[model samples]
Target: MVRNVESSVDDVYEWLLKKGVSQKISQIFRELLAEHGLKQHISDATHRLGHTLDVLITREDSSILKGIPFVADPGICDNNGNRSGDPLAIRTLLRLSKAPRERRTVIFRKIHDINIDNFRKDLDFSSVTYKEASVEKLIIHYNRVLTATIDVHAPLKSKEIVIRPNTPWFTDDLYSAKRDRRKAERLMRRTNLAVHKDIFNQKCMQVTKLIQHCKSQFYINKIQEIGSDSKQLFKLTNNLMGNTNLSVLLEHDSEIDLASKFGEFFIGKIQKIRENLCSLTKSPTREVVLRADIKFDGIPLEAFEPMSIAEVCDIIGDAPTKSCKLDPIPTNVLKQCSESILPIITEIINKSFSEASVPLDFKKAIVRPLIKRQGLDKDEFKNYRPVSNLPFLSKVLEKAVASRLEKYLNDYQLHDNVQSAYRSSHSTETALLRLHHDITS
Candidate 1:
């Protein structure tokens, strides 16, 4: 009866293990087993099992765990007054794991000399005590506080350039108002160069045309009187030149008066056009790329993804699996994720979340459903089954899949109406490809 009960308990423990029960629960079970003198039986049962079982049962179990009071040991002080290799002291220092060896050594030396009680008192956390916290928890708390501090001060650090008020020019009372007006006119002209350029170009062309027309009219009227006295003609031409000069001076003054009156409206219109262009340039636009790969029993077969030059470099460096499996198909289907299929999927998920403007937790929501639908564990790749010897059909199906994914990603709009369309399209494409392959075989 005792043996049967022991077996039953073991079975319950195994069931809980499969369900991913907490370490505390597992430890409690182990204690119960030890109390029943079934520890020997468990040892025998787990003799052939991997060491992972032992580690999990020991380190992860909190029920049998006792909190240890951290004691400070004295030593020499470094520049930062932090100690090395001591987890508690390291946590107190808030030093990054990736700190330089020299820096770490200094930190270690400094922390080793500190009096724990006095240090705690110095911090003056009367409301909060560092009494019974693990190294991991301490590190996490420090990081949180540091992050909060940075966030609070971030806005003040961001200095934006602004236009300052113009200083008034010093002048005599007689010409001060007139001088100020002239200065204002000059400032306006200098600032609105594009508007002035357009106006000047247009008016210059108009003036040139008017001068040509006048010259043409004079020549046409005298065409039949070519034999008239040359001296008399020269005198007449000089008089006409004088009259033209006077007329041009009057026209110039009139144009300047017109500009003084209406220049603001033209300049404002130009400025508005520029501001519109600037806003358009800064507006967000969707940039989509389809990346897909087919794997045959975990080994990548074909990979393709339409990528820019910078993306290509990143893909080469980070995604070696993609480099190995070059896509053979000539279709628009480019295979993308080849290095680690999981990371590729994660990248896709991230892109989707970003496009949707949803929190990253949505990734977990989508991933769980997809994993369940596939009836595969998150780490279950060992049992992956490859499609049988239908090389041509497989290639065709893969290409079709790529094409469908590309089209969907490219056209997907993250609006309420079309948000699910990409996901639906992907599913449909995969299903159809599977069906077609099955029927053909």
Candidate 2:
């Protein structure tokens, strides 16, 4: 992030340099230098807390020279014959001791570069170090601000309701059990409905308040009434609305009809508010579902045929020889088998329209396995394997493993010594292969 910021600034600087604005830019550089010099002076003066104490002590004495103690050399002789110590330093210390008591108000005013008298009027400085002030004033001022800002009220109100049934004579203990159970169930249902209604109402009210708050007139009015503590008012209002008990409101609703009506009204209002807000702002961008087509050259392949596991093993033969003796199948026969069995391969190559050849090693490795797995005899041309039996072949082909292997082999270009070793190894392997062929024959 810092590098990016530096790069952006450098770009602007370079642009300015090209435009020949170096002389004009020096004005800003000079202002920055002045600021740095002021900062250095402040840093040197307040190198430690002791330095602050010295400044405070010295500032109190109007008669003391500014640079006397700081610049005075004790080694140098003065005309006053004060060989024991630096005369200027001694005089400055004496003057500081004799000076009038320093007022914190005056010091703070000077440091802040503000008028002390006016600032004191605007702020309650009883807790601050003014020479004459009572602690009670500080407490009162602090309490007033705290009381104005903080909410100390409970938001919920509770009430109990007594329900009398339509039938009065059903008052026996057994009857009362049945009656009470029904009443309790009804009350529970009502309470739940009321609670839901209350929550919905509160949500709607919040949306309404938010809309009102967004209005310029409402914000201005609120600020005018609350002064600088409008934030406290908004927070208190939100807390009060959030804490309001919906269950209490629900208990007052006698019938389910009334509860349902109120719930619908609240929901409708919320929906309307949502629509209004959404319309005023930009509608959210819809998520685009990306899909890719597996096209062979220009057209989708109608059939797919994969190499069987047996074919794979055949291609990567377990023989100890450097290379296995492959069966000499005719090119036309192999091409026909490729077209009929390896439909997936054909599909990948865009329905045999592609110019690229199926790699010889890959065809041997993959196709044989698929054919074997499908339980098809390689010699029997009558029994061809179904394309759907081997779905994994298509996935394997998609991996581009052959391309990766080719890249790896190409990248392994041998250095001089490594090349010599590789060539020697190759020669020995070739000689062994020839001898093995003769012996096996």
Candidate 3:
């Protein structure tokens, strides 16, 4: 075994030519490898006899494989310390492509950083201040103005944030305690003082107790939040037991295809329901009059009155600060600028009522499909339900409509007297009381 010959990139081209490859083809191959940032590591002979028989290739810029693969003596060790000259041993250490500190990008606007006074001033002078004849146009203008003003003040910014596995019980207080414990341990190690040792011991006990307390409280709160939902409770228990939450993977090539399949499944279910309804037998029946001499005393509700700015402001103020991604602005931001935008919103609501139509933006909703419960066949679309989230303005408008409709119903005595559900001051308890009174009477 002796090192006598060295092989280079040129030697590879020569070999390719010896194998009947044309000069042009060899040149193209070399160029392709170079373009892909490939590197050849085995320049020295690997065989026992001095010939470069093996090639080690890797990405030139990748940290996944560093340095060259170690070329052990071309032989296998036998039981009696004998070497068999057949295969060579190649060794390398493999590493992950990304480091632990790898960061991800997140786009968000600092809504809390916005100045309310400046925001109000900007909205007052914005294009939304001018009234549009059509409700749709007015809504579009309002959305544009609000979005632009908020963007100007808050601005959509991107931040590279590192994401790592986290425990639900790990709170800021617990983190602080751990940090103090480590500092105390370091002081004890450096000073070798009895007080420092005692402090470290105390810190260790404090951290241990905090960890147990935090973990127990976390589970307790989670169980309470889950309440009587057996599915959630079982899922939590499984998670605590280190069982995977992943369901059976559906057959699809890509995410888009998977989403399409889900859509098809839900649509097919709806179609099947419609088909069943259509197949049902229909019978024509005569209507029986309960009171032949009864007169029509209720007034017909055709249109709603335009709400005042004060009323719109009150409604907006009382509304919960919940928002959907489809909303033009955050609910809190909208509330902060309500004074400047109240007239525009009030006008839009009145125009919508007059036209008997809602803005198209308000009609659009974001739909999310969630598994109905754990321990169910998630691969089956039947086990999933669609939850739709409407924008903030949509909910506000609906509240206004509901209030007006309720007033109309109350004024005309249109509601059923015995109905207890979905009515103010009436619930299951009231329904039970009514049943008791009827039984006693």
Candidate 4:
């Protein structure tokens, strides 16, 4: 993966040589240097926790509404209840100070198992109010099992351990080879003898070849796993190429301040949509009355019914996993699930549409600010546009709604021909053709 977007900010200073890119762009890079540290904390948390949580924050008060414990660094064992370090840490260390690496690993694993018993983590959807396997209950239960397993296996959270952006694919053997290569490089730098030079060169070359081979194999496996999904392939490439990392402004040094700044600029913008004023319209003028009377009769409707297992399977199967919306349970996993499980999933989708109510959890969105262009002012928040990420489950629910709604619209022909942009299978070319036909007519 790429080191960081702002990791090379010092090089921006050397851009004093070339007057090509504008000073404003360079300043933006400089201001973004603070994001590197924030990103380091985020990365470390992800590594330790197996999965990352989207901190529900609004700039309104600049406080995290949930999951602050997950984001904060797990510094020295004060044991204030973040499901962190052993309460008996000093005692345990005194007992096992001379333990071997293998024994230490075993001991920590036991400690982690014990920690799970004592620490009361928040209940995600699965474990909450679960008694019997109803549609929602079964779905959430399956997700809970998978989620708990993943959380159980995640690296033990720690503080200030050098957060290296080491590739997840790196093995102990490769790491050892890399260490040896570094040693060889250092030795060659210090020595002058021909014997030393030859041995160092051979050893370095072998290590270099092994490293290249390992990296190639790792990426190849990843590509095969992604398998013809161009978007996921592109995301993997971008991680290596360093494109997706967000730059944090130095003015907002800590994430807390950035959260506050972002909230200040954005929270007020979230206006509650006004109530349906049209429903309360006491009087309609002549033009509005005439327009209301003018309606086109559409193809007759069949009774609307629930989606089928086959249809549900198709929708899940076609879902693109490239979307950055992470969820407790991923759609990719859902797609690959056994056919027998499809009916339960279909039941969940059916009841959701039948009731026409979506949970508030589905509606919550995480906003990430993206810089629009090269000359954006570093100091101004307005230069950035917000791109919101939704949970994968929300998108799946959205797709279910759209499918049912589209069928309804098609049956009644309520969709206007002029709306070529959002209509399935319509394009800019179709819009142009329609315009040309109208002109000729």
lDDT of 1 by residue, 127-188 (tens): 22334543333333433442343233221232334344332322243244445445555655
lDDT of 4 by residue, 403-437 (tens): 87798888777777699977899999999998999
Ranked by TM-score, top first: 3, 4, 2, 1
**Position 44, candidate 1: lDDT:** 16
Stretches of candidate 3 off by over 4 Å are 1-103, 124-132, 164-177, 180-203, 213-253, 264-295
- Cα lDDT, model 2, residue 34: 45
TM-score of 3: 0.62
Tens-digit per-residue lDDT, 1-441, candidate 2: 335333334444455566787856945743564455421111112212212111222223245444444423346555886554322232234334544543332111122333334322333223433123233332233334322322121112344434433332222443544454555556656787776565555555554554454444544665577776877787646743665322212223366654465446555666998999777565566444544343223323323333344433333232222211222221222232332223223233332113234433323321121232343454432232222222222223443434333334445531232232334245666667767888999
By the TM-score metric, which is better: model 2 or model 3? Answer: 3
User: Which candidate ranks first by lDDT, i.e. highest?
Assistant: 3
Please give the range of 10 consecutive residues that has the lowest summed lDDT in model 3: 1-10
Model 1, residue 325: C-alpha shift (Å): 40
How far residue 150's Cα lies from its native spot in candidate 2, in Å, is: 58
User: Higher lDDT: candidate 3 or 4?
Assistant: 3
lDDT score for residue 434 of model 3: 95
Is candidate 1 or 4 superior in TM-score? Answer: 4
Q: Rank the candidates by lDDT, best first.
A: 3, 4, 1, 2
